[model samples]
Target: MIKHRLFWPTASLLALLLGNFIANPGFFAIELRDGHLYGSLIDILRNGAPLILIALGMTLVIATGGIDLSVGSVAAISAAIACLQISKLGDQNSISGMLGAMGIALALSLVLGAWNGLLVAVFGIQPIVATLILMVSGRGLAQLITEGQIITINSDPYKAIGAGFVVALPLAILIALTVFVLISLVVRKSALGLLLESVGGNPEASRLAGVQSRRLIWLTYLLCGLFAGLAGLMLSSNVSSADGNALGLWMELDAILAVVIGGTMLTGGRFSFGGTLIGALLIQTLTTTVYRLGIPPETTLLFKAVVVMAVCLAQSPAFRRKVLGRRKPKPPAQASQTQTKVEIPA
Candidate 1:
């Protein structure tokens, strides 16, 4: 069962980590300084926190047999709104102001989520088509919010949310881990996980079984939006600026890949947070490796694509069978008997 659940992804992650360590012995080295832990592994967790959050939410949505192409756009918009709010405040660096901005950003995310849920759940539009509508238009909305320009700020309190350390761990990592724990508790410690699996396995059957498929589906998208919103804040806060045009570009694709590599089927059903976490780490490690190796920009993408293809094929049963060869069938009883009789006569 353990092997069935997360063998490939976990092994892949460990292999990547080992490779990184081989390339640089310092990769796994950790040191303490003034009550803070610092290292390459810590950097990976901090830098990958946003992707972890996005993928965490994506897991739930995909579990319900749906996709959210608009998550990247939602992230952009959330960053724009939060930055705009912070920049407008009289005390821009105040913790109160930052908190307020965060609240407003999260509220907007909920609204955006509801809009998506309405399009798919109420209007009965296909999930991909519905999300595509916002995915295409959300950037424009973000652009308008930022007035077609980047909004920069120098707020220490806001910066702390993304870049600060708590108990020697990054604040962003803490936030992401907190959310991960809460979600795991809610989904696993209750009946919610089974219900989501049911809905994804067969919506009609789930509905017949009295699972509120529409409500659950809608809620999953909303949660996804909320997670994206938090990620946007962490992103903008890290840089202390909001660049709507560039912010969160193609992150949805990364999130989906993380979900897929984490052992979550694109067709939907069972999901694994542990696998998602490992997948996110593996991706971040790969990106770090490319930079560390000084790979040229033109060739970097190709390298990544090849690696991703390998991982996908590794997860494919058909590919494994083709590569590893299938088991040979046993000889027929009649053939064995004839061979024995002939050998005795000889």
Candidate 2:
């Protein structure tokens, strides 16, 4: 279990939960309220849904040896696009209208992803530079879509996507988990996962081995945009508004951190779905612990950094070996001197 890819991430999450439980005795307490489960644990899942969704996409992008800095912007644009369309609806609560709005947001987000893929996969631009271009540009586009203002709405169906409950579980949590499972199935059950690892490990080798590296990279980016769009919808719906400026600010960074903490190498290659899941939960748990323990909001980043670094070090093989130094073996000459001569052997 200790050697499992998800072991450290899971342990970190468990530790955070334990700390929270220690800090607040009621942290683990859960009660059914209005047909839905309510508790700090539930809250973490619900709130972290967006991050989980975003991180899943980041996983795919990173597995292709690419980074998507524009995810935050894509998320913002998606939320803005949805809210703007919904705001113009004759009845904001219309489920069909909300669905249509969501579709629009997703479609545009995919297009944005394609744009990044075009620059990187087709035009041969660096992934970082390609995605960065859309990072700022997409933010501005979102602002333009929302007319530089927050778009607030009152749509029960739309809100439910982010805040509703189903079978005693938060809808957002279910959505995140369902996406995770579905993505895992698609990637693992098919050849896509292997291809991604191959391309990420060595694009030149993969290409030489007949892999369509360009298409794969582009496809991953497109999928990343789609996932980021879904997260945007959840975030906007959760608050019932879209603040173009604040909708997904720095979300890319958080997703990246979550992916990294999950044991996925930033340099790319093999990825861990389970690790990402555990890592996202751990992050949300830590955030909850901070506020529950009455830590000041101003120091949240610093606090998170400390805990994340500690967890990271704990999971690092080199760091662990350094901390738990092995017993040194005697030199060959000393061993020979320590041994008794076998005169009968001659």
Number of the top-ranking candidate, with lDDT as the measure: 2
lDDT of 1 at 245: 94
TM-score against native, each model: 0.93, 0.93
Q: Cα miss at 38, model 2 (Å)?
A: 0.5
Task: Give the alpha carbon lDDT tens digit for every residue of 235-335 in model 2.
Answer: 99999999989888998988898999998998889998888888888888887888888888899899999999998898888787778894455666644
Cα displacement (angstroms), candidate 2, residue 27, comes to 0.7
Model 2 local distance difference test score: 0.91
For all candidates in order, the CA lDDT equals 0.90, 0.91
Query: Which residue pairs show backbone clashes in model 2?
Result: none
Worst 10 residues of 2 by lDDT: 327-336
Question: Model 2 off-target regions past 4 Å?
Answer: 327-346
